[model samples]
Target: MARPPLRNDLIEEITTRVLDGRLAAGARVNEVHLARELSVSRTPLREALIGLAGRGLLTAEPGRGFLVPPFDPDEARRLYTLLAELEALALRWTSPLELAGLPDAVDAVADEMVAALERGADLSEVDDRWHALLLSRCPNPHLLRLIEQTKPLLKRYEWCYFGGVPRAGESIGEHRRIAAALREGDLSAASAMLVRNWVSTVAFLRKDNGDQCASE
Candidate 1:
């Protein structure tokens, strides 16, 4: 089957599954296997693999098929830190770009998240969509690319935390705080919120998710 666009949504879905340990890291994902798993065909799966490889979520080796890239603590921290800097810069250094349409975009996703929380909904999809909206508004291409490259990796962690692994919901309030800061155009608050959110979540997951690398 043909997959359309290899869009962020599809890639996020696959990345989430793999990261949440649902697919198992280092597991194979050939065209046929993923096609069967995803209910799509080889073409779309190939496109997805290419997209993920570019994002660093999957590695494609010569003469070998695609496999889930092992989690690297340093790489993960660097990617998240880079994202934090880019996002904080976008919030701080940009000359007060009027967030004319941002609140609506933010609210839409936040509302979905709120509902998920209300129903004790699984939050991975909501997390993916919310971050997608938050990052897409960034004004710089370099920043956007940084975000794009990190989304899959972050999505993996988010999926692990939000998937059936049963993580606590402490970050929920932090996300709300970031939304409030963005709404109010409080760069300091937004930056602080992002840093705190990233750091705290990373701390929470470090216990059993992977090796406790020197980075954290």
Candidate 2:
């Protein structure tokens, strides 16, 4: 029999499912089906589920096992606010010398996002790469780790936001502006733009939800 997947690997696999909407929000995690599909026994799978719950990615209730948490606009707002401040602070901490070459690198990723938008492709991954490059020079490992851990919670909402072609176009423009600010050696401007980038996403998601509610 195939050996059970390692803990980290199992966590990653389940996380992917959650992020991609394969498991879906507010869905109960079927431990049996998941174990059988993953070719692992229930024991290891349950352990992974409990771990995910601890990470706030899943909810554990009495006799309910594990469940994918429902998407909440309030939660998204709080997360986006937290991420914006964290990333902006990271930009502040990045040294001038480290950011010297960032503009060109960031522009390249922005161009890719533009091309993806033209072809009706997903821009979320490229957008993420741009943000990663923007903050690549941050010296604090702990701050970076906090950013990394907080980002997964917002990925599903980002996927929704990027699904709209116009929204993706707007994001590309915002990215270009940030890069332009960096090109001029203006870290303050770049940091402000970075925060605005995230804030706009929250606003868009909120408006989109409102529009949906009105239509319904």
Candidate 3:
């Protein structure tokens, strides 16, 4: 197969497994196994691994190749705190900027979330897409890049963290509240909401897991 297509397919498979928590945090990975499972050669698998390491989705050791990055509770909390401040800043800064067509773009995520929950679905795709879209609205490329790095790392323990949902309808409530705040140019409330939402999200996700880490 062509390098580009083969690379894409392998990346998709790897991403799906990771997001689904099938590839657990700190889990060992085997290139040969991945190659066989993906029905591709090691060359493409190696290339995908290289790119993923650069993306901070995996830790690339000199001899270890690719390992699921460690899931440290303290580290995660610190990262979440940083993200909250960053998001607060982003929300404040992003409030006045006019996004002519952004309302529809964001509402699409809300729509998907509602539809997914109605069907008793995972809604991970809806969640991730909404996250990326909202983060992209931040003016600084560096801020966006920082969030991009953080999200993938947190996704490993995501399932064990969130596990399941009771009233999935609540997912869209924040979406509506945030959107309404953004529409009214209420930067202060929006910023506080961003901080509160993410800070609570980390605690909510960690509640059931009880900080399942070696250090803890």
Candidate 1: count the clashes. Answer: 1
Candidate 3 lDDT over residue span 1-216, tens digit each = 444446767766787676665675677778888777777778888888887878777778887778877667666666668777876776555636653335567778889888888888888778778766776666788777677666666665455456345434555777767767767767677567767666666655554364565322
- Tens-digit lDDT string for candidate 1 (62-140): 7788877665655666666777666666655445465435656766776777778778767767876766666665568
List pairs with backbone clashes in candidate 3.
none
- Could you tell which candidate, 2 or 3, scores higher by TM-score? 2
Model 3: lDDT to the true structure: 0.68
lDDT of 1: 0.65
Model 3 error, position 196 (Å): 1.4
lDDT (Cα atoms) of all candidates against the true structure: 0.65, 0.84, 0.68
Best by TM-score: 2
Candidate 1: where is the Cα deviation over 4 Å? 1-23, 31-51, 93-97, 100-112, 162-169, 182-185, 211-216
- Candidates 2 and 3, the one with greater lDDT: 2
Cα deviation of 62, candidate 1, in Å: 3.9
What ranking of all candidate models by lDDT puts the best one first?
A: 2, 3, 1
**What RMSD does model 3 have?**
3.8
